[model samples]
Target: MTKLLQWLLGVSLLGAVWALVAFDLLELSLPRTYREVAWPIPLYLLVSFGCYSLATVGYRVATFNDCNEAASELHEQIKEAKEDLRKKGLKM
Candidate 1:
């Protein structure tokens, strides 16, 4: 159920973004008679949807538990091993 809700949320957010982009395009291309009463709706929606999309990206990034720190630590260990090997004239 949680996964389903998450999927729905993502889909709805993307749909909102698509709607805003479509609205903005139509607003630019269509005649004055075909335009909406409020010109800001698309811009507002676009910004809001953009924020949500960014938030989703942020969430994913946070969940990933990045390995850069671990990699750097391992690299430091390797560097120390190389230094020790050079000091001892040992092949490693």
Candidate 2:
């Protein structure tokens, strides 16, 4: 659900950018279009999807921890669980 919301927001942002470009609102010295705007929705979607996928992969890689780190975290959790059980007078 969060992913869906993020995707929607990204596509909306890209659409806004495309609109600004297509209508020459930014005026970045690009060639101006005088005809009615025919926004290529499909192409914009493709570009947005590509960008989102790249960003997601980049974020995962940036925050990823090594296997040893993960194993230690799991070990700590298990130790805590056993201590809690022992306090409850339960044998493990």
Best by TM-score: 2
- lDDT agreement with native, every candidate: 0.76, 0.78
**lDDT (tens digit, per residue) of candidate 2 on 1-72:** 699999999879887877777666777656544313435655766899999999999999999876998899
The lDDT of model 1 is 0.76
Clash pairs for candidate 1: none
TM-score of every candidate relative to the true structure: 0.31, 0.34
Query: Per-residue lDDT of 1-92 in model 1, one digit per residue for the tens?
Result: 79999999987987676555546554556555334544555578679999999999999988988789999999999999999989999865
Among all candidates shown, the one with the greatest lDDT: 2
* Candidate 1 lDDT for residue 86: 90
Q: What are the clash counts of all predictions, listed in order?
A: 0, 0
lDDT of 2 at 58: 100
lDDT, candidate 1, at 3: 95
